[model samples]
Target: DARVTQTPRHKVTEMGQEVTMRCQPILGHNTVFWYRQTMMQGLELLAYFRNRAPLDDSGMPKDRFSAEMPDATLATLKIQPSEPRDSAVYFCASGLVRSAQREETQYFGPGTRLLVL
Candidate 1:
């Protein structure tokens, strides 16, 4: 079984900085999701894609957070002008939806760690 891979597992940055994280989904997976974990917001869904088409991103912080798919196996998340509250563990998940309304199992990458000082 293939697995999702992420780079720069840990990052430390100053306030109002830019952070970029990368993820490689499973080879056959067509859906990718980006999420941010925080004690206050809990698990916040940032964005997701189905067949490389963005399905929803209402939970994302529009001013600073952005997600994109440069290819089938690659997904990237960027945070510009990061704040102290932006420090969290960002996770990338990939899966295939067997049905339009239902989602298949998502395999998670180890995640990229970000810290703002």
Candidate 2:
């Protein structure tokens, strides 16, 4: 079975610290996405990449957060000067984008749980 995998499933850090999370997408998938879940915003797509190239990251704070795909298998999300409001679960999902379809199903990883004190 194809599945997405993430490292450091849980993270706890003091406010203003830097937090980094990594994900390994399922092999053969060409699209990857990063999402943040909070009670106020619910689930928001922070970034997305197609064929290992970043396509959008408008949902994230440009000064404090960054998302990148180092390679075909690896995707990373980093938050510098992390704040209390940034504490939330970050999810990485992967799937194939079909030109014929308007929507495609994505398989999500277990997610990285982060807490900023």
Candidate 3:
């Protein structure tokens, strides 16, 4: 299908629990960005992916957070042993690249809201 459908929605969980987030992609788009928002830091970029490959995830805590794209239409972010500081509204945004133009602006997903105690 050419339309985006059945993307993963929000989530809520307690502290120390594991959280897994998935994004059902839009057709033809090759890039995804994971972001999280909180009162202190506002919006922060947690991961960036392109062409079904993870290019950078420096913003996420290596010990707890992981981002991966197992295929072209699926992207995932996992947090193990989530902490209180990890509580935030996590969002997945996607975009398509055009050769003649700058990168298009990404649109956010339903957002997974995590409350880690």
Candidate 4:
């Protein structure tokens, strides 16, 4: 199965220590991203319909869904710890949204099944 393997393989790490998470894009596709609904940053009017800048997670609840765009070519989504809230990726769609292009129809992928405890 397609997956991402984070380095260190540890539950936690010391401050200043470098950590890396890696994943590969599906064949013939260039985007490998997801959206999460946390109690913090839940859907804010779907402001981010797609994983563009700020990786729109407006579809999320009001917990803590953190998203960032370190640069123009990379998008990152950070999952926060929640007791009663499940941080798993419920809906994952494919396709690209490049500049000056029409938005294409996206197909949903199966749930990541990532249950954080």
Candidate achieving the largest TM-score: 2
* Model 3 TM-score, all chains together: 0.88
Candidate 1 lDDT (Cα, whole model)? Answer: 0.90
Model 3 lDDT tens row, 1-117: 344332345566788898888886676888888999899999999998989888888898899999898988888889998888888888888888888888597877778777777
**C-alpha displacement of 10 in model 4, angstroms?**
14
Best to worst by lDDT, what's the order? 2, 1, 3, 4
Clashing pairs counted in every model? 0, 0, 0, 13
Q: Put down candidate 4 lDDT per residue, 1-117, tens digits, no spaces.
A: 543322222224333332232222233443445544445765223223233444445554445454444543343444454433443333343456676777665544443333444
| RMSD to native, candidate 1 | 1.5
What stretches of model 4 exceed 4 Å from their correct place?
1-33, 36-52, 90-94, 98-103, 107-111
Instruction: Point to the candidate with the largest lDDT.
Output: 2
Candidate 2 — which residues are off by over 4 angstroms? none
The CA lDDT of each predicted structure is 0.90, 0.94, 0.81, 0.40
- Model 3 spans > 4 angstroms off: 1-8
Ranking by TM-score: 2, 1, 3, 4
